[model samples]
Target: MKIYKYKDSVYCDEDLSCEYDNYAGDLYDLYLDLKEDNKCGETTRYYVCDKYTGYDEPEELIEEEFSDLVIGEYESED
Candidate 1:
C-alpha cells in the first residue's frame, strides 16, 4: 500500500479490485474540508480510518479500524 500526503490530506492507494475507485484515506479530513467550505450534504458520510479493510460500507470499515493492526515503515519521497 502506498500512502501519499496530497493537498493537506492523506491518501492511501487501495487495491479494491476496481480500476477507478482505488484510493481510500483521509476521509475524515475530506469531510471536514467539505463541511468547512459548506459543500457537504445532509446525507454525506463521514469516516476516520487510518487502516485499510477492503470493505464497501462505512460502518463495517469503522468497526475494523483498530482490530489486529500493525505498524509498517513507509519511506518518504523527499
Candidate 2:
C-alpha cells in the first residue's frame, strides 16, 4: 500500500488498498523513501515490521521528522 503523510499521522492511502484501513499509528520502521530487495523487489515503503515493531505509538511528527524515521538498508531486510 502507498503510504501518505498528512498533518502528523502517516496512513495508508485509502485509494491504494485495504491491506491497511488508512492505518495511522506507530510503525517500527517507517521508510521515508524507497528500498529494493531481491525477493519483494520494490515493496514496503512503511512497515511496522517483525523485528522492527515499535514499543510505543509514534507521536505526531512533522514532514521534517521523516529524516528521524529512517529505516536503514539492512533494517528492511524482510
**How many pairs collide in each candidate, listed in order?**
0, 0
On lDDT, the candidate that comes out on top is 1
For each candidate, the alpha-carbon lDDT, in order, equals: 0.37, 0.31
Worst 10 residues of 1 by lDDT: 65-74
Off by over 4 Å in 2: 1-10, 13-17, 25-61, 70-78
lDDT of 1 at 19: 28
- Clashing residue pairs in candidate 1, if any? none
Top model by TM-score, which number?
A: 1
Off by over 4 Å in 1: 1-10, 13-25, 43-78
lDDT score for residue 24 of model 1: 40
TM-score of each: 0.25, 0.19
lDDT computed for candidate 2? 0.31
On residues 1-78, what C-alpha lDDT tens digit does candidate 1 reach at each position? 334332344443333223224334543443344446553323344333432235454333323442222122244445
